[model samples]
Target: MANSPQPPLDALYQEALATFDTLLSQARGEGDPEPTAMTLASVEGARVSARIVLLKGVDARGFRFFTNYRSSKGEQLAAHPQAALCFHWKTLRNGVQVRVEGRVATLEAAESDEYFATRPRASQIGAWASAQSQTLADRAEFEARIDEFERRFECVPVPRPPHWGGFVLAPDRIEFWYGADFRLHERQCYERDADGAWSRRMLYP
Candidate 1:
């Protein structure tokens, strides 16, 4: 008798991608707004912070999102250069959870600019006006800043702000979890090694 052949790591990754696409599509069709929202966690030394961010892109490379470079999360990533992300869909009956852990890097300027161009004009101006994660004197002051930027870009295309751009999290570990009865859930994890090879394993639940 011969032993069973194991599936390649890349195959498992593709399967995970397919599953994500299917779930996302279903969520959208079921009228679940903000399906792309995810929780991003960052750390610097002993302190850690987590926030909700919208996912901008996903592919074999990793997950992508944009933020103000001067924000707290941005500062944390700069100091640590690694992070984790969690995506949960509770609207579904069984529910699904995805976890990703990886190193982070800033996206190229051109790529960021292209994505920025797709944002609504008001949002583009808001991106320019905001001093994210910083103390604001009052709502009036922030609105004034928005007004200023609005006047400055009148009848012109708003360019991506220098401090606003995207970050790509190149995942080293990715896990998918499915809710089960009696809390006996299922989990599948894929990890990349130093040699750039991937390995897949099942996690006890």
Candidate 2:
């Protein structure tokens, strides 16, 4: 039930974030056996592109995700330096969108090394095999590359690719949306202030 009188913007934003986290947990226990991943968007002049990538880490400071540093998103981010992330939980009919304007750079080599060592052997090998965002001749060629990498690194620990790593998006603004009957959805937005604190606002439905 809606609060008979809507609460303050900060309260509303916090409440929506809590609800979204709860719904995400419920979604995880349902049909999808995958981890919570988000579609990351980056721009190039008039073009925008996005792809699903795993959520690697998060904190009050930022959200982090790892990928091949030579991938499409990487290239786009290198040029534009800002990106957005969207997480849609269809089962819950809810979504969270965050617009982050921050500098993008590779994670420390040690950070990447530690994470890579924790990944499954096959994924590590695949990381080396893939020339991410580059077109391959065919499926066979990709498989052949993977096979070659596997053979060359057999009985040895696969090292993290120099061209693969993580990016932390320091969000300047984050919006949480909840769908309601009659299309009067609930929306709460948080914007970072000059003092480095976040100010919350409620948008008209």
lDDT of each: 0.89, 0.74
For the record, the alpha-carbon RMSD of candidate 1 to the native fold, in angstroms, is 6.4
Query: Which residue pairs overlap in candidate 1's backbone?
Result: none
Give me the displacement of residue 167 in model 2, in angstroms: 0.6
Best by lDDT: 1
List where candidate 2 sits over 4 angstroms from the true fold: 1-23, 29-35, 93-103
Please list the residue runs of candidate 1 whose C-alpha ends up more than 4 Å from where it truly belongs after superposition: 1-9
Q: Flag clash pairs in model 2.
A: none
How would you encode candidate 1's per-residue C-alpha lDDT over 30-117 as one tens digit per residue? 7767889999999979988999999998887789999999999988998899999998887765777889899999999999999999
The positional error of residue 204 in candidate 2, measured at the CA in angstroms, is 1.7
